[model samples]
Target chain A: MLRIENLNVSIDSKEILKNFNLSVDEGEVHVIMGPNGVGKSTLSKVLIGDKNYKVNNGNIYYYDENIKDLTIDERSRKGIFIAYQHPQEIEGVNNIDFLKTALMARLDKPINLYEFAKSIEKLSNDLKLKENMLYRNINAGFSGGEKKKNEILQMRLLKPNLVILDEIDSGLDVDSLKIVCENTLEYLKENPKTSVVIITHYPRILEYIKPDYVHIMKNGKIVETGDYSLSLKIEKEGFENIGTNIIEDNK
Target chain B: MNIINIVNNKISNSKINNKIKLKENKNICIDIIDNTKLYIEIDGINIKSNIDINIDENVNSRIFVFSNSIDSKININVNQNKNSNLILNSFYKNDDVKENTIINLNGYNSNIEYNYSCIGKTNKSLRINHYFSKTNSIVKNRSVSNNDEIEFEIIEYVPKGSIDCNLSQSSKIINLKENKCKIKPILLIDEKEVNASHSSVISPINDSDLLYLMSRGIDEHNSINLLVNGFLVNNLNLNEEEKHILFEKYIFRR
Candidate 1:
């Protein structure tokens, strides 16, 4: 359902991603594994139409339409959602209010309040999130695990066709991470038509949600693409020997 | 639906005889709507404005006034007797407008809270003076101005040995256009025992924050609107209807 080819991105006259290529079909999950500062987050931002990262050369297609010309909201309307690595704290905007606005924007119609509350309660219970969080401001004073659960809750409510989870398991403890992984996989199982791109440096998340494709990103480009076994290899042996020199890998 | 229906003002000095006095257990509320205008001038000589509010008193008043000429000046004195409470809010914004306002208080055991939010985007000048005498009174002032055409000055005075009084002043201005603007907030504290603090920030939005929001589907105008709303939300004590009217009039007027 998603395809990116020959993507070249730069920021502040510094080249980051060079000719990266990847493709994920429907009912498939792709996990991008890479070290820090290796442009994993950059790829996520670029796909969501982040303006800071300039795309020097690339073509991204969702379904059959070119998404490079689309705005972030337009992309979101087309079923693209990005769970930010660092969730922002919006003080006065209630979490339920924000989710409703976003869901309505995506659906082009006002959601039923009763159904919304019911679904949110069910999802929160499954994700182990506090029910009182629905009335509080979005991510305001939320613990790291709480923030990740909030992201997943949004993902569930919006029901986007393509959901990008960026470093969602980093700050979560073992129990919370297990809960998050199980909830995410359950969502995917329910909507088997939906596709996901999980971005993380570790493979522990894979223990819960099995991925179809595993891609290693070093520097700014995708150096290797393999089945789920590739993820295990990267987990066992570090990314130091797989790609070229670190500088050339960065090129 | 309408809180204060009509505003009837008589500018002549004879109207002073019918002036209303607030008792120690009373509360007062005044509202304005539909192109209402009021011009008040205080000569700054022997001012006696006293109102006895009750404990846990609630006073809601909105005073909107602007000067058309350069020589317009108003002196206001409010003295609250001991153990009373008051909340005073003020908003100022005008172009090619000049006005001077002075407030003085003399030794009353009252807890008075004052808030001022000034947005001057045009050619204007304002001089404000505030002096307090009693202890344990708290004053908070927050002002934000856009554009560079307006000149503003604020002066504060805390008398000697006023203990437990706290005052905070915050001013933030953004120079969107190329015009000269100056904001000077002066705090004169003669009492070392008082708690006083002030802060000012004058600059445009950070490039990184701007980029961050823009990347999240918000354009420049919407980003600025969010920031401006955040800046003004704390001082907004409007009811539901008033808040709706304000959003319709000023916020969503585009």
Candidate 2:
């Protein structure tokens, strides 16, 4: 479970989040739909403790703890995960190595490479990822779909309690989107205590993985909160018909 | 296990009778061999020395050298004859080492593949000189260095009128907790009809890479360790299990 109170985030002296507040209970999935420049991606990054977004006035709480003091990696270790819109292309950093290193970080002993390799192969297969890409540099030359699947592969390997997916369905084709959404739903089913927060401009993925709550972000704030029908409304009618102007999209 | 092992050096120029000769087509697995003195090749001999290989016309051979030492220097010269092919693999882990490998593709249509991996505990230097003497000779060199300096040089010459020879050099260096480390890859091509290119990377584990790894619950130091190990040892020609052991005992020190 995660909670935010009166959060105002800014980057380079430009305001991004204006008193944004939201809360998601355990075993729940929440989706945030908005037009361009509505701080949807910024909120996801802030939740994962990305340092680029400076919190001017706010406090993020996870369970009973105020995560304001936690570092980026600290928040990640505390069961907070974020899937970026564009995963970085890292050369010479193998996917298996990255995953195993992250998995080993929680342990005090040396990593069991053989078992780690087996688990990775199994998870990658479950995600329909190429086994060879696991050996290559992390997302170095991967296609957009491959990048999305790789993100899911990390989610499977990491199994964090709270998953934040930012534009995960943006670049995926129909088939890849289905695979990603199906795997995500499967992961949620396995971890009933887990929660998901997806930020997107389209509702196609909501058709695959329905959310219990939908929030429409505008002008650095959530202006409306409703159920899955909110996402459907934004899908049929654009954000303009949702009582928000294009001029107010970015603040 | 590594391909080459370094044992005690036996042949010294201090004595006058240090010249060593060998039979043709002979395969040797020893601690050390000083071909300058201990190896001799004569005509009409079916000789194939695995170490210090020399491929004559229409000959194809492969060699492996696995070396481990505190301080040593080994020089290997490979000469490819007309229409000949040679593949050489070298792996060395040492504290102080100075090694120079000279490869000459002198005959027409000769080809060679050379790969070397080295782990440096202290100050060490490695130099390689590759020569393309005749037409249509292809040469490739790949080297990996960890913890110290390496100067890899390749000189591809398409002797006037020599046509369509290709040369490639790739070198990677991982410098962590290492302040005195550097890599220099020099490619010298002397002909217009030849294709030659070289790339040398000397870098620490980048900050973004560390952040990416740490975002998955890995700490900063462990993230750097993982990145260094991946850069230095991944996708190499040696044994992964054996290399993992080496990392635990020696490289990782845990």
Segments of candidate 2 deviating more than 4 angstroms: A107-122, A130-137, A241-251, B1-4, B10-68, B89-93, B119-161, B174-184, B235-254
* TM-score of every candidate relative to the true structure: 0.75, 0.78
Candidate 1 lDDT, B1-254, residue by residue in tens: 21211112212221111123222222222221122222222222222222221222232223322111222223333444334444544443323234343444333444555554445543222222223444343443333455435555666677675556666666555555545666677777787776777776666645544443433444566555555554543454444454445446444543
What C-alpha lDDT do the candidate models reach, one value each? 0.61, 0.68
Specify the highest-TM-score model's number. 2
lDDT at A246, model 2: 25
Q: List, residue by residue over B1-254, the lDDT tens digit for candidate 2.
A: 11222233321112122222322233322222222211211111121123354566676555545454555655555666677665555555555556666666767777776666666633323333334444333333333344455554444444555667777767665655554555555555556777777677766657777777777888777777676665545534435565565456445542
How many residue-pair clashes does candidate 1 contain?
0
Model 1 ranges off by over 4 Å: A244-251, B1-77, B89-105, B116-153, B173-182, B203-227, B237-254
| Error at B223, model 2, angstroms | 1.9
Clash count, predicted structure 2? 19
Poorest lDDT segment (10 consecutive residues) of candidate 2 chain A = A242-251
